[model samples]
Target: MLANMGNEIYRKIEQVKLLPLYTATDLTYLDRLEDILVKNNVRFIEVTFRSDLAIEAIKKLSQSNELIVGAGTVRTQKEAKDAIENGAKFVVSPAVVPEVIEYCIEQDVPVFPGTATPGDIQRAMEYGIKVVKFFPADIYGGLKAINALSGPFYDVKFLPTGGINEENFMEYVQNDHIVAVGGSFIISESLIKKDDGETADKALKSLIDKINLQK
Candidate 1:
């Protein structure tokens, strides 16, 4: 039943097609940020554990039914448990951590482990994971790398993050193997730090427009 729940959450992510990576150091503007995301129709967000306030941010944001909150940059079973306890509906990690993956699966939470090579992808597949994160994508050859990896693992879908931005995100999203794109591009850290809701709103609207055009 937990596996089914994980699959359902994955489907929701695919439908939205954008996974905004958020890092919060202060909670002052979290509500405003949530408002911008909701107003733009974005349904999922990955609050990265890059900041000390990430778990707290997840706790606060997960309370809202308007968005599905997830924990990102998670690398341990302890972090996974804490994030989930605090209300994160899913977990994302920079690399494949067996313990973390096992914990998430046992708990039935969707997990996306990072992969940058065939070895990593194969390892994830061995663990029964169908979707994996392509990290530092730009440095690893970007879309070309993902396309190349697709040849051997055709059944696997990728969520390419790192160095992705508005100009190149569409290229990745258009690919058949891409489940969804993950990055800070849509709602950048700079924008958030400034509490610039207007700009963030415009960025998200533009992205939604682009996705609609593709459809």
Candidate 2:
């Protein structure tokens, strides 16, 4: 049952192809963000645990049947437990935390832990995880690094996050090794903080259009 659930979520992630990494500082803008995502037909969102309101944001957004809400920047089992209890359908961490990964797998929630080096990917592979996040992708050699890593770990897939933007995100997304590209480029911090729904909507639509055009 748990493996089936994981496969289901993985299909959704692949279909979306773009995972919006969101950080909610103020609770008021979540509705606006959700509205924009739904309007643009975006089905997956990773609400990072970067703010005090993150748990509440996850709870509120996950209530919507239209979205698959996940928790990001999670670094511990306690945080993972909190996110799941509040309705996060998946869990993402900045680094591979054994406890968190073990906990998520035990609960049957999909977990995408961050990886930067071969050692990190090797560790994650030991847990039977195929898809992992290539964090700070830009600083860590971007697609070049992923290409290198893929040589040894041929079956591993990546969700490249950090430093991904409108200019280079497609480059990562186009790679077969990447499951989906994630970052704050589309739904930026400024846009969310200012509650600029129009800009946010346009950005998301534009990217979605680009992705569609690529196909």
TM-score list, all predictions: 0.96, 0.96
For model 1, the stretches where C-alpha displacement exceeds 4 angstroms are 1-3, 193-196
- Per model, how many backbone clashes are there? 0, 0
Q: What TM-score quantifies how close candidate 1 is to the native fold?
A: 0.96
Please give the distance, in angstroms, between residue 53's alpha carbon in candidate 2 and its true position after superposition: 0.6
Lowest summed lDDT across 10 adjacent residues in model 1 is found at 188-197
Model 1, 1-215: lDDT tens digits are 44476788788888889999999877877888899889988978899999999999999998877889999999989999999999999999999999999999888888999999999999998878899999989999999999999999999999999999999889988999999999988885579666468878888999999999998
Clashing pairs in 1: none
lDDT of model number 2: 0.88
Alpha carbon lDDT of each predicted model: 0.90, 0.88
